[model samples]
Target: MKLALFLVLLTLSMSTRAVLDDCTCLVDCKCKKSLRPGQYYCASPDVDTDSQAIRNCNRDTGTVEVPCYAAPNVSCGGLPYNATQCIFTESRPCTFVNGKRYNYYLAVGLSLFLGMLGVDRFYLGYPAIGLMKLCTMGFFLIGHLLDFLLILLQVVGPADQTGYYAPFYGPLVSRVLVNGTDPFIESSSSCTL
Candidate 1:
């Protein structure tokens, strides 16, 4: 029975791998063969080899790729695509602040638990505010609530004017406008005065 079950699992895994190997582009793009065997790119016909809008693919392995611009020092405004060219772009995620870093979850935890003692303020390097909170018991509890809200919303950050360390596993919010367009809108057909 164990051997039969193993064979069944093996068959399922091979079938899944086969399905993944048959991935294809959904857009009206053409395949441009690469020098590597079974590897190619899917891109618009109008785009040249120098263009950054190409999507790499492997026909043999069946891997879908995310298109990205490879230019150095180019900022994508936290989006997947370039703001100017509308082509996909990639950037490294940052968690540093002035050569140091503080964990986001740790800040939130400190604020939630020991905010009244001003430990959270001290951790964030705000010594003045920490002193005030320590003396007044978090400003009669009002300041503690306010600080908690500020920290939760990510409005208050490190003392160096840089951001806090990013969480390892959670949603990351980036307030970036792409192409000067409103992200709340679903369509761009509306006429403006």
Candidate 2:
């Protein structure tokens, strides 16, 4: 039948020119082809050239790698890239040192509703334990329930220690244990009697 419709329109124009030559666009803005093959859709005039931003096509230096909010000094842990909304996140939420960040849900909502007026130890600056928990009112309440469980288990931070500020959602409380793996899982097999 006419040579099988000319070999099915030359195999659909050679697989649509090899999917438009592997979705070209080496980044100069306005590419747009991504249906999820190699991913391609530029328009990043530093994150708002009309906001397309999908970026991922450097199949051997084809280029497209500048959008961590334009790179330079790229911060997330110390939080600065215009205070983050995510151009690319590894998840850091807070770390600021001298400038101080402090605000894990406003120190657990001022240690759970004003913490017997110690005001969460003066909002975590610890002004002499917030004047001794406002002259023992909170202390009489057992230091306002142990300072609301040590500021909700963040273990009472911020007297310029610079920690809390994480709550984009809730419940973080890390206290460091990264890459951990040796808690006595029992593997001592070496008896050479």
Model number with the top TM-score: 1
Backbone clashes per model, in order? 1, 0
Q: On residues 129-170, what C-alpha lDDT tens digit does candidate 2 reach at each position?
A: 888888888888888988898788877788866456563234
TM-score of each: 0.44, 0.26
Which pairs of residues collide in candidate 1?
Answer: 21-62
Q: Residue 165 of candidate 2: its Cα lDDT?
A: 57
Query: What would the TM-score be for candidate 1 when compared with the true structure?
Result: 0.44
